[model samples]
Target: MAVLCLMLLLLAGDLAAFMQPPVFHPNPPTEYRTPNCAQFRLPGCPRDLNPICGSDMATYANECTLCLKIWEDGHDIKIIRNEPC
Candidate 1:
């Protein structure tokens, strides 16, 4: 009886530990950096709908966001086109 009770207590403890929420690890499989893509600029920019194609071949929301990316990430992105992709 005492042995069974001990086993049950250990099992309960194990079950409780297993039921815990998984811990979040940063960039589990691969390292990643969040892009500084923004819809609006801090100093305020024109609400132009003109999309600028980045040198990375990605179309930005506007020139403001593109400039932010360059300034923040130091990306070698340049204006490819003044239109959306």
Candidate 2:
């Protein structure tokens, strides 16, 4: 009986951990997009989006927005977040 109770507890813990949601999401954040999805950052521009990166600043930002919505709700994205703002 004691062993069975311990097994049950362990199973519960595993389930709880498994129940947690993933950090990344299918969609991007609306407010966290890049500047030039296809272009790179210039001298003064400090572009946001990078064509090679995940998504364009605007597109990816929109998609990544879901991440914030699901995880960091009501959170503001940093301009120079990953790379140049």
Candidate 3:
């Protein structure tokens, strides 16, 4: 009877350990800037609908988008016209 009680106690302890919730470590938050038209020089530019021509002779969605593309690609682009080529 004592041996049976000891076995039951060990089984209960094992079951309790197995039923525990797992621990998780989440990734750290990254810093990101929200894009907009007003800040149309580089990093954060809006994806607007108005198309424009760049000095590099490339068409972009808009002035803001053009600036962003130019900034990314290192192109000498500027607002040639407020229309697509």
Candidate 4:
């Protein structure tokens, strides 16, 4: 009987620990540096509607459009996210 009680107590402790919520640690934000775009001279992009967010906090029509802008203005533009800003 004593051994059974001790086992139950240990099982209760294990259950308590398992019932607790898990802790989450998010990763730190990434730092992005602009690259030189002067050497890349790309052609015109297609007229698509797939929007994407840029590191410059602007919403681009698509990845091709973003590349076109980088080639045209010679600015270091990067895609921050796939969705619109």
Among these predictions, the greatest TM-score belongs to: 4
> Which window of ten consecutive residues has the lowest lDDT sum in model 1?
27-36
Model 3 residue 74 distance off true place after TM-score fit, in angstroms: 1.5
Tens-place lDDT digits, model 4, residues 1-85: 9999999999999999999998743632265434333434458566879897777788888777778877778777877667777
Model 4 CA deviation exceeding 4 Å by range: 1-41
Model 4 error, position 57 (Å): 0.7
For residue 64, what is the lDDT in candidate 4?
A: 78
| Top lDDT hit | 4
What order do candidates take by lDDT, descending? 4, 1, 3, 2
TM-score, one value per model: 0.43, 0.32, 0.45, 0.51
| lDDT, model 3 | 0.66
**What is the Cα-based lDDT of residue 15 in candidate 1?**
100
lDDT of each: 0.68, 0.42, 0.66, 0.73
lDDT of 2 at 68: 35
Which residue segments of model 1 deviate by more than 4 Å?
1-47
Candidate 2 at 38: error in angstroms? 9.9
Poorest 10 consecutive residues of model 4 by lDDT? Answer: 32-41
lDDT of 3 by residue, 1-85 (tens): 9999999999999999999998642532243223334565567656668887666657777777776775678755656566666
- Give a tens-digit lDDT track for model 1, residues 1-85: 9999999999999999999999964433242234444656554666767686676768887788777767778776766566654
TM-score-superior candidate, 2 or 4 = 4
